[model samples]
Target: MYLMSKGLWGAIAGDETTSEAKEQQAHAAIVLNLSDSQLMHVIDSATAREAWGRLARFHHSHDMANRLWLKEKFASFKYAASSMSGHVMELEDLVMKMKRANCGPSEEDVCAVLLRSLPASFESLVQAFRMSVASFSFSDLVSKLIAEEVRQNEAARVEDATALYAGKRKGKQYPKKQQVRRAKGPSGTCYNCGKVGHYARDCRSGRGPREQQHDQSNVAFHASEGFASDSWVMDSGASAHMCKDRDAFEEYEEVHHARSISSAKSNVKLNVIGHGTVKLRVWTGHAWIDARLENTLHVQDLSKNLFSLTAAAARGMTVEITRNECVVKRGGTPVATGRKQGFLLYLNADYGTECHMAEDDTELWHRRLGHVSYGTLNATVKDGRIKGATMKTNVACDVCATSKQVRKSFKTSEEDAETRESSRSDVVVCSDVLGPITPASKSGFSYAVTFILMKSRYVTVYPLRKKSDVASAFERFYQDVKTTSGTKIKVLRSDNGGEYRNETMNSFCKAKFIKQEFTVPYNPEQNGMAERMNRTLVEMTRCMLKESGLDKSYWCEALMTAADIRNILPNASNKNSSPHEMVFKKVPRIDHMRVFGAQCYAHVAKEKRKKLDDSGVRCFFLGYEKDQKAYRLLNADDGSIVISRSVTFAEHSVTKASKSRDTQVFDVIEEDESVEASLTDDEDIPAPVTEEELRTPPLRAQNSSHHGPSV
Candidate 1:
């Protein structure tokens, strides 16, 4: 449209008679295609002429058009372009003419002309038009403008509807003026004067001088006398009353007595409450009041005003309210109630008043009672002769005698033995053999012997089947003890048992370079180490067996378990250092230990588990594994034992009978000699027991059968 308009004007201004000019006019006519009447009106209007000049200037200089002219022209062209209704079409037209005269149009110049022609209502439309023209093709520019106009109208309509519902506007109209309401003031009767219209401070009928004076005087009087010389001043908000110090209470007693006589008396009783080693009941004439007693008391009004009255009162008074209550009483009457507030007490008083009151009360009370004075008295003796001399003796009591008792001395032993430090490596191993195939253990093997290291005091035990298996027992003992002590057996100390003197044992020790240290035959105490270890192992085994309430068959388990415990437990012979520490250089953690024969819960591993399992297996903790981080467990249901690292112990799960018993026994023994023989043979060593060896008879026949036969 702009091109057609500009082209027609250009043709008219140039050669009107030429065919090229006529052709341009014809092209403009076709593009314009306005009706004759509309064209005539457009041409006759002076506004159109002014609009053309404005458009021309906007295209050349890019200045703004008059706002009034833009508004009127937009109103006239509302139907032609809704978006351009509030815009000055003449300014835009002039820009188009200049652009057509120059060849290509400048977008910035066109935007400036359009913006200048835009009225208030078309501001958004003009912005939309500029953006649309810049971003879209020329053909889409007009369509986008029209669409933006429709969107703007719809948005305005929705806004008006929302405002109407919110009671902010009626329809799409806005009011020229708005009114606001003012806030109201508070209303009520005044507390000071009981006036309905005013507040307390503004009350006209003021308080009287006499009433005010009385209040002031009352405050002053209370400030001066409310807290007695001995009385503790406390906040009124406190819930319970407390008299902690005896001195505070004593001072209070003196002042209270004086006040009791001076006031409108009705026998007011004050019971001080407190708790300590002993309960105290202080009865003074005052009423029971509610207050709280703090553990610490601060007397801001006095220097060194705090005292441990609870302890003093406990030592000084004796009275009862209720067993749980810390109450003071006069005569047999109850005066105070509640839990005893025991501890220190604090009070505020003048130094002079405290001393004078305490002294006067002390003198008066003594005179009244006619009791002997503590220090001195002013009483004069008749004829300068003191009569009825009073004597106080400081005699020692039962506690003093008991505490000061001394024990009689005894002579020291004359025997002196060599003393020297020795490691396990330097020790001659020794042990006593004592056990029998008693009652046949669950594994069908029952025998136990104590094995001790002379240097390190480390010990072990081996269970056997028969005395004849002594050779085999020695092999088993060597395997266990050697691995534990990590040392070669250089010497073997033992009683002169036939087992130790056997050719096979002597030959084996000689071959191994071990010096067999044997005591004289029938004189066992010479091998005191083996003898003592034997006694110790027997004692431990007895304890274990008694504690477990099981038959002597499990004696092997008890022996092994006891040996392990003893090895770890501190021994006096080793300067209270356990064998484990002497060897391992570290204190073993005993936290995971469980009592022998204690019930234990063993977790079922995936390999051991089957589908539909409901519960875990129950077992007894035998002992710890020496080689691995595992525990030796004995399943009671099955005599077979298994080593596991995962198990929960129920230390308190001992049965009634087991608890009553004093001993417990849980033993483990290698049941098959053939297996042991095979192992020893595989190591290129002689079978621990040869068939011929098994045929040996007992050296000493079970004579009296004392504790069965000592192995």
Candidate 2:
């Protein structure tokens, strides 16, 4: 890559033409990717490659002191049986880093080190490696090791599946032929059968009708449970913007111990740390729109950041959610939008990160929380509790005012009551289409569909190119769920979309002996199961995107990740069990879960990368790969997504902050090992400026040398 006009490259190019402007942009990007120390010396380099070489030299020299330190760690490392590949990957990355510094071992030397790192269980492989020619390179050894690792992982997964299904089968009831009933007796009374004498009193039957059926009603409307991570939840149930990050406030006024939130059938006492203005960053149609949220309640130790619909409605703003983004409109004009992440909706990229806070007043309580009845206020005052102010409200699930009595939105009666019993998995399923997400996903999908099982509230999502693909998606999903659960789907419910009402879908369902139920043409509530599922997946997908610091183009992957996490979480209707447990009959192992967007190193086999290239490639964690016991990671270098069981994650507690794009700064959130590589931004790196340049006169012309550093 020889540079043309090399002298003018590193220093900013002339604004002579559009091509020159692009070259200047490229030059700036190359510089911005440098770290603070590297930026100091490379600032005067005459070409991008020159600056890069200088940076490499600088980092190499600095990395020297720790060379022996890394060597010792490599020798002493022992691969853990639980995650041997991950351990080996970390060691390999360390070796690569040391090699870049010109202070690393030779191929044979590294091969010996890798063998030593193996556990006793790999002693057979160790012997095999030892007996081979000593000329064998580290890359070849790594390939063999990785092959063994993948095989072992597949065997373990198969064992787990076998054990789970076998145990499940031993307990599940399968239908058998019914016995013939004896002649009817007086009033059809029978001792064995509870029915009016359809059978004789002494009638022999394997089962008795009088025995009460297993009561599954107890699983309904259950209480709350803890989440694996404290991601924000955009809840229809929450009354106001409830936040845990005190740094997000523009103003604050702490109230003494207040416990206003009630969920999961238990009361959590999160004292109102303060109330103030918080700015949330949203995507408005195309660009970012920073929206200032007022009257947000900051609570200490809160599990999630909640954005209330009631608050948005109060401010004359409307929130409309879609598959790719959440749109907030004012009088039908879309003003703000936020991409979805796992189970949360957010605008600012760093929504939960710590930010600054100022002080405020207690009067904002009555000023904000909602529709306070004076009678209830008096009761609260006498009871030594806080009371909110009265306001015209539409919040049926307001968080702040739940302690007080509220007016009911609707009365429960015959018409509104749910009559069907969804007591078995896949007995009743609902599905709906979500989008035409403008720029399609990596899979070239512009639309998506959601299928929810009514009994367990378990969701399965499929990305689609168009609504027409609905039949194919359903056929695939039907086979997967049926094979996994060993149960046939009884019925499917959806809106009257042509995709669902068409002959293809109708004929397929009819052939399977499955019923198809349709909600009225314009009534979405009638198909609420799938409607709510669509919302949940979108909300959760936005949270994952916001958390990962990735763009919206990855929404399909984010949605899949969101859906997976959601299934493992407790169902709102049944707090005691998660959808995964209900459907799969086993608790999911969530202990191995890492943050969605954490920095990691994925082991690259010799077959994948060049021999001299790094043994591991830098990646950002996307989510777990479906149907495979591996992680789904995006190659940060090329934007290609890959799945691998051999990967190492660098975990750290990242600080969250909210800022407008113009002033936003990247917080190098990673363990020291990966910080340098993670700091490089592909765009928007500010050029280094000196005090001399700052002091120069603005009127200086193109020839003034005093202006400094200009090409």
Number of the top-ranking candidate, with lDDT as the measure: 2
TM-score of each: 0.34, 0.37
Give a tens-digit lDDT track for model 2, residues 1-711. 122333444333333443655566556656544433345777887755556677667656435568778777767765432233334445656676777766777767777877887754457788987887666655456546644543333322211011100111112232222322232334556534555634432445534443333211000011112221233444333346665654355455665533233322222223454677776655567676556767777654454465554356546776665544566679998776555442234443233222111213122222211112223223323332232223222334222232222232233235433443333346777787777665567667777777777777777766777789889878876776677776588889887888899999999999889899897655665664565455445544554455455666676666666665556555435456657677778755433345566677786765667856776687877776654456888888898887865565543333121121211111111112111110111111111000111112111111100110000
Best TM-score goes to which candidate? Answer: 2
What TM-score does candidate 1 get on C-alpha atoms? 0.34
Deviation (Å) of 29 in candidate 2: 48
Reference-based lDDT, each prediction: 0.38, 0.50
Residue 277 C-alpha lDDT in model 2: 70
Per-residue lDDT, model 1, residue 480, is 47
For candidate 1, the per-residue lDDT at 488 reads 73
Assess the local accuracy of residue 603 in candidate 2 as a C-alpha lDDT between 0 and 100.
69
